[model samples]
Target chain A: MKVGVLHSRIRRDEKLLLNELRERDHAVHKLDVRDRSFSIDQAGDQFATLELVVDRCLSSSRSRYLTAWCERHDIPVVNSATTAATCADKVRTSLALSEAGIPTPRTEVAFSIDAALDIMDDLGYPCVLKPVVGSWGRLMARIESRNMAESLLEHKATLGHYEHKVFYLQEYIETEGEDLRIVATDGVPIAGMRRSSDHWITNAARGAEVASIEVDSELETLVANVDAAVGGGLLGIDLMETQDGYTVHEVNHSVEFNALNSVAPIDVPSAVVDWLESICLETTAVSS
Target chain B: MTDEACIVCDATVALPADVELGEIVDCLTCGSELEVTGIDPYALEEAPELEEDWGE
Candidate 1:
């Protein structure tokens, strides 16, 4: 099958896929999205005769728009454009999860500082203040008091970016120094890891130690519900334990599995490529 | 004249005759990895940091 790789930089994740594709004897076309322009028609000769294109661009905006363009031209892209857009924005993901009755942290949004502070009141103190459009816990803060809330709001107001003022405050789930990062395809868990850290934020990128974990029945149910809510694709679902149960905080599009690869017993990248081949081959069989 | 000016300094760094996007070129003056973002006029941007972060 002819495979088109849409990427800006080749990280470990992409390198794994590229190597697997080569080993499998599939033709790989590396489409650097930075220099690729979208025409209303074919875009360019690079897109011709491609069976599947993977959206792996580093920038959310670029990946979303380019995938949309590909869809317009009747091309197939894994983790389609709609899924990318929904997963990229925190507010949209929240809405999708809430509407589907998925258990997520109690979250509130406000446009003004006063309204945000009022929301902080409803959620109570020690809640988290997070940027609406970031990952790996960048720019996320824990507001422990009303005074801190006021100061954060003031600081946020002075920022130039519009996203800064759109406050997304979430209830800080008190867990036992860990959270779950499960990599799954559609609704099925491929590999699961426990990110443990001394700090409140347990993201693997933030010096958290990673160890493999078992996928319990409860986790399976939650991820299945989450996959349905997010429209299904290769995704990373983040969950935190609460007094009630496990509440999913985020689902990432174009998820990274290199860290999970280290601890998981299963060959993570090979499994992913096998899944990718299955999907592409099945689709090609149908069309031809 | 297919060279692009180094983003670090105003010194010109010669680009390959068939420069493609995502190709990393080095700055002769400052020794920074420059990525080709454009080809028509040969534009370059500082290579993005490669640190793995929480998934996007």
Candidate 2:
């Protein structure tokens, strides 16, 4: 199988996957997003030749654009352009999850500071105000009081980017200072990790402690539901345990699994490569 | 007597008079991609690793 890895950097997260692909004797092509220059109207031969390309790009804009180009020119990418668009934007992710009847954080988006404060007030203190398009627990504010929310909103309102004006507010879940990240491919949970922190945010990148979580039936079902809700591919499904059950906060395309790999008993990269093999084989069979 | 140096090969390269910030310059000697990181000293760095978050 020929696999195209679209990336700008070969960090540990990427190296893991590449090793797995090579171990299985699949031909791996590395396309650096930074060095790559291609025509939108006509794809270059290198990109056009790949049977299946994995979108591991670090830049969201690059990922979306390159995947869109691939889709336009009939290249099958894991976590397709549609999925990338939905997952890369929090506002779109919320709509997709909620629309699918999945239990996600109750979110409200406002355009102005006043409207945002009003929504934040309604949601109450300790709620989260996040950038519509961001990751790694950056630019996320947990409002503890009206003054704080006001200040944050005022700061965000004045930012130059249009996305800053979009006040994405969410009702914070009462998780036990921790959350779950399940890496799934096509709605199947390949590995699961529980991330805990002294602070509210529990992202691994933010120094959250990660430990393996047994994939119970309920968790597996939620993984599948959340994965499908946001257009399934390779995804990092974030879940917060609620009083009733699990509430999905986000589903990530271009999902990273280096952290999950460290804690998970299963070899995540191997399973992922296996999945890629199946996708290639299936596509080849159908086309031939 | 241009002072711009390639970030990768440390070799000198001529920059266009109107070269702008964020412009990518390929190293003539090493062929490494260099990005204009600063202009005051006319500095360059091996292009910053391009990355974006997953909203973790």
Candidate 3:
């Protein structure tokens, strides 16, 4: 089997996957998106022979565009471009989850600062303002009052980036400083982890303490539903335990799992490779 | 093992035998983040800073 790992900087998560693939005697090609160029009608020789490409690009824009390019070249890539497109934008992810009847935090998008203020007024203070395209909990604020909202909105408006102008606001879910991250492929969960932190943002990159978690029947059902909603590939489904139950806050296409791997009972990288092998076999069979 | 100069401090930085490309290593003398750019002759360059869209 031949596998291509698309990445910019090789993080620990990518190293694990690459080691697993190499251990299985798979020909692993390291495709650095920054060093490579893609033509509309052609794929580089490095991409020509790989059976599958795993998108591990750190940049969301690069991931979205590179995956689409691979798809155009008829090369099978894990976490399809459709999934990438949907997960790349917070607004689109929220809409996809809502349209599928999946429980997600109440979210609204506003074009102007005034419109955003109006939505903020209705939702009241203590809501979350997130960048439409970002990860690791960066550029997210907990608006505690009208003054705070206005100050943040002014800064964002004047930042000059078109993305900053688009305000994505959501109701802040109280989770007691904890949340869940489940890694799945095609909707079936491989393993789960809990992120706990003193700060509001419980992202692993934010120094949240991580531990392995058990996926009960309810979470399993929701995971499957998320896969259906987001058009499965390799997905990281983030959920918060609410008074009602579990509510999905975000779905990540190119998810990192080094922390999860350290605590998970099963070898996460091995399980990931298992899924990749199965998909490769399926693709090969179809092509034959 | 390979020896290369730190792009930031020009100090000799030793790389591990299995160092992979784009692998980030901190310069012991200067504490600068250096990325492995080549394997044959062993080249090191300053790692780029993270961009806003760079995350999962």
Candidate 4:
């Protein structure tokens, strides 16, 4: 089998996958997105022979573009172009979850600062303001007061990027500084972890403490629904425990799992490669 | 093991016996994050700065 790991920097997560593939005697091609260019007419020699390519680019923009390019060249990519396109944007992910009748946070998007303020006024203070396209809790503001909201909005307005101008506001769930991150394949939960922190954001990237979680029947059901809502491959589904139950706040396409691997009872990367091998075999069979 | 010059400070830095490609190592002298772009020829480049759109 031939596998291409599409990445910018090889994080610990990518290294595990590469090592697993090598152990299985598969031809692993390290496709560096930083120093490569793609033509419309060709996938070029590096990408032409691979049976599968994993979208592991750190930059969301690069991941979206590279996956789309690979798709255009008829190369099979995990978390297909449609999945990557939808999951990369917060607005799109929210809509997909909402339309699918999945339990999610109440979210609103405002194009102008005044409109955002008005929406915030209605929702009251202590809501979250986020960049439409971001992760790791970057640029996420917990609006505790009107003054704080104004200051954050002003800074965003001055930042000058078009993404900053688009205000993504959501109802802040009182999870007591804890949340769930479940790594899943399609609709099936591979393993789960609880991210806890003193700050409001509980992302592992932000120094959150992680612990292994049991994938119960309820979690399984919710994740399956999320996979159906948004097209699935390898997905990181983030959920917040509300009074009602768990509400999905975000879904990540190119999900990272080094933190999970350390604590998980199962070998996270091996399970991932098992899924990848299945994908490669199916793709190969179809092409042959 | 390999000894390479820090791209920022020009100080001698000792790399580990087994450093993988794309692994980030910090220069002790200048504290700059350098990435291992090549292993065979032993190359180093300053890591790219974080962009707004860079995230998982």
* Best prediction by DockQ: 3
What do the candidate models score in CA lDDT, each in turn? Answer: 0.84, 0.83, 0.91, 0.89
Give each prediction's DockQ, rounded to 2 decimals. 0.21, 0.16, 0.81, 0.73
For candidate 4, write residues A1-288 as lDDT tens digits.
888888888777888888888999999888888787878788887788888999998889988888899899999998788888889999999999999999988899999889999999888879999888888899888999889989889999987598889899998888989999999998899999999999999999889999999998999999999998888899999998888888999999989899999999999999999999899889988998
Clashing residue pairs in candidate 4 (N, C-alpha, C atoms within 3 angstroms): none
TM-score winner, 1 or 3: 3
Off by over 4 Å in 3: B1-5, B10-16, B28-30
Q: Which candidate is the best by lDDT?
A: 3
CA shift of A22, model 2, Å: 1.3
Interface C-alpha root-mean-square deviation, candidates in order: 5.0, 7.7, 0.8, 1.2
Whichever of 3 and 4 has more lDDT, that candidate is 3
- Kindly list the per-residue Cα lDDT of model 3 for residues A1-288, writing each as its tens digit: 988989989887888898899989999989887886788888978788899999999999998998899899999998888899899999999999999999998899999999999999999879999999999999999999999999999999997589999999999888889999999988889999999999999999899999999999999999999998988978999999998999999999989989999999999999999999999999999999
Candidate 3 CAPRI level: high
Per-residue C-alpha lDDT of model 1 across residues A1-288, encoded as one tens digit per residue: 798988886556777777778889999888877665778766566686898898888777777787798889878887888888888889999999999999999999999999999999989989999887778878889999999999989998896378888999998888867999999887889989999999888888788899999999999988988888887888899998787898989889878888899999898888877878888988888888
Candidate 2, true inter-chain contacts retained: 0.30
What clash pairs does model 2 have?
A58-B52, A135-B55, A136-B56
Mark the regions of model 4 whose C-alpha exceeds 4 Å error after superposition: B1-5, B9-18, B28-30
Write one digit per residue (lDDT tens) for candidate 2, span A1-288. Answer: 888988765545777888788878888897766666878788778876789999888777778888898889888788688889899899999999988889988899999899988998899988999988888888888899999998888877776487888889999887878999999999999989999999898889879999999989998998888877888889999999888898899888978798999999999999988899889999888878
Ranking by DockQ: 3, 4, 1, 2
TM-score for the A-chain in each candidate structure: 0.96, 0.98, 0.98, 0.98
- Estimate the TM-score of every prediction: 0.85, 0.85, 0.96, 0.95
